[model samples]
Target: MIKALFKKEFIDTIRDKRSVVAALFGALFTPLLFAVMMTFNIEKARSVDDVYIEINNADMAPQIVELLDRESIFHAELPSTGKKFELNGETHTHSKISLTFSDDFESQLSSGLPANILINADYSDQERSSQIRRVKRVLENYEGAVLNMRLVARGISPLVIDVVDLEEQDTSTPGSKSAIILGMLGVFILFSVFVSSTNVAIDCSAGERERNSLELLLMQPVSTFDVVASKTINTGLFGLFAGTLSIALTAVVIPFIPLHKIGMAFNFDLEVAVKMWFIILPLAFFAAAFQLVTTFHAKSFKEAQTYIQYSIMLPLIVPMALEFSKYKHAALDYLPIVAQQQAISKLIRGELTDFTPVIGGMIVTMLFSYGLVLFTSKSLKSEKVVLGL
Candidate 1:
């Protein structure tokens, strides 16, 4: 009897041209978008050339120019000959630089007077900041080396000028390397969940209602619970398939990424990939169950679809809001998507696999799925939800 019900639901879904097309397009569209975005980001970062700086100084300017050249931080270009500076040009004023020396630069230094150098840069260009900082550091080095030479000439030990030196150590894990990508992964999961499950859920509930076929199925020998359960299983199966495809496509594409060039990159683990498959299966079940409950009470396929679309968006909005609000994930060892994301992130970076979260997420997902199915079955007994009220 259960097999018959499953077969009927599958056949109904297949016959619905709209549902089939939605799933196919959603599945193909998502991977292509991910690939294109990743490729563009990698190439853009890898291709930026070193910046160029122009200096106009009389005294000690040669020393500063030598400092800039030694670091290879920026190339020194001659003054522009054109009447006007064109920042829009592909090569020339793409950026502007100015370095000026004091009128009494060498005299001030000889008399123990404070000396100053002026640096002007196009602050509007965001990429120019790092090069600016690098140039500033080289200038500081030149100052320090000169100070040491002066002190030694006066028979003074340079040790008196130094007190404490500090160093910084970055302890962030490689998994946590790209907070943005993890955030992106969270978004991608939410997208796949909604796109994969929306059509199936709407078709099973509202679609059935619209066709007048739901009434005939209800009149049969099967219990209402069985009917609801069968539909939930069918929708979930499709979601699980879509989820698996998304993950598989991610794995295939990640290795091709230029990890070293970009500051952040995704590393794949076979074990994590396997674990994601397991984690997503239960998540798919819960997603389908949740969608069925939201859609079951609607009058027409279109009405049910509208309600389910909102339901699907909840997963996307909530996780993202949590991430943006900087809400540290609770002990996700017992949470669903939180745990799966946490564990998968760790696994990707070749860290210790916390099975506790994986098992906990699975159990929570399944329990919720069962509860949703029960609610859906009970709602079927109400004439309002079943009879188009």
Candidate 2:
């Protein structure tokens, strides 16, 4: 009997063209969009390797020019009008970095006076700003070397000026370093479950009522628990399909994103996919039951859509807020969506060994889902809900 009810609900849901299209689109679009954006950013990062700057008085600082050349910064002739042009089938804009050395720079250095080297660049341009900082560091090194030579000639030890030796050692792994990007990926993965179940939940509830068939189903010999359980199961299956599809697509697309270019290593391998699936599957049930309860309360199909749209924000906003918060409480890992996000993030960073929090959250999520299904079943027996009063 339960199998027949599930089959009936499942067939009806798949036959609805709108629900099928919505499910497929929600499952596929986010991963594809993420891939395209990451690919574009990687290409832009690679383009910074060959930086071209303009030097106004090359003769004044031959040694400095040599330093710039070794640093991969070459002088280029650019238009004085500052107009955009095309190069190699791509539109190009010249960076506004100009170097000008004073004519008496050598004399000033010889006399132990300050030598003037003017760096002109648009500070507002992010790419140009990075190049400008590189240029400034190179010039400072040259100045320090010349000053040390002058100290040696004067019978003074160069170590007289040496004080503190500063060094940097970064211990972040590629996975940990990509926290921001991975956090966003987790959000999209979790959101797919909600999106996949949305149309089906609404259809089985308010949509059935609008079609004037919900009353007929309610009058059947089946218990209210059976009816609600069958609908929730159907919705959950849709959510699970969408969530799994998103993970598969993400695994396929992540490898081609050039994340290594930015020192961000994200491996959506089979193990990670399997872990993510476990983390997200219970959320699918929760999403289905929650949406079922919410939609069952709405007076009409359009009104149900409005309620579900607002409810969707809770999942997106809550997890993101927890992921980015400065003050993280350890108890957050025991919460539903928050726990799942943290687990996925740790999995991405390869730091997750203990599954206690994840399992705990899944159990809590399932219990909550069961409670919502019971509430929805009880609502089905109410006259106001059945008659849309």
Candidate 3:
């Protein structure tokens, strides 16, 4: 009998265009958007390799120009009027960086006097800022070499000027460095579970009430527990479908992201995908039960939607806030969304070994889900909820 009710609800939800569209949108849109954005950012980072700048007096500092060339920065000619310039027959907008060397630059350097080299660029432009910094660094290197040569020529020990040597050792792995991005990805994955079942939960509860069919269904021989359990199971099945699709799509998309270009690595292997799907499974049930409890209280479909929309903020915000917080409470590992996020994050970083937290979280999540299911079943017995009074 419960199976028949579950099949009915599932078929009705499948036939609803709004529900199907909502589910597909939740499953596909976010992963595609993340892939496109990451690809664009990585390509932009790669474009910084060949930086072209204008040199007003290239002959005055051939050595500096050679240094710039070695650093992959080359000279380009620009018109005085417009921002558009051509390189190798390709029209390109040039950066504002223009180098001007004083006529006495070589002479001043030869005499150990200050040589003026002015760098003119738009400092506020983020794309050109790195190139400008690289140019300045190369010029400083040239100046330092000349200064050391002058000191040696004067019979002064160049080592006398050195006070301290600083050495840097970075111990951060690629996975550890990409923690924040992975945390956000985990949030989106969990969010898919909550969002995918929202419309279905509303339609089964409030929409059924609004259509005047809920009371008639309640008058049947089946107990309230059976009815509520059927609806919750249907909704959770839909959430599970959406969550699975999200994980599969994410695994496919993650490899295309050039995280290695930025010194970060996130491997969404088959094992990780399976583990994530496992983590999200209990959350699917929790989401469905939670949504059902909230939606069953609303008098109509629209009211339920409005209420659920606001209520959904808790799931989205809580995990994200915990991810961004500096101080983490150890007890959070046994909570619902927080625990799942932390577990997935540790898994991505190759740091998750103990499954105690995962097991604890799953148990707590399932218990909470069943509690909501019971509350929803009890609510179904009330005349006010049944008749939408």
Off by over 4 Å in 3: 49-58, 69-99, 119-132, 148-162, 323-328
Question: Candidate 1: where is the Cα deviation over 4 Å?
Answer: 15-17, 28-60, 63-88, 91-99, 106-113, 119-135, 148-160, 173-180, 262-267, 320-335, 349-352
- lDDT against the true structure, per candidate, is 0.73, 0.85, 0.86
Per-model TM-score, in order, reads 0.78, 0.84, 0.83
Candidate 2 achieves a global lDDT of 0.85
Q: Which ten residues in a row have the lowest lDDT in candidate 2?
A: 78-87
Q: Write the per-residue lDDT of candidate 2 for residues 57-95, one digit (tens) a residue.
A: 788788999998999887776656763555668655666
lDDT by residue (119-183, candidate 1, tens digit) is 88877778777777877898899899889998999999999898876678987654566545555
What lDDT score goes with residue 8 in model 1?
86
What TM-score does model 1 achieve against the real structure?
0.78
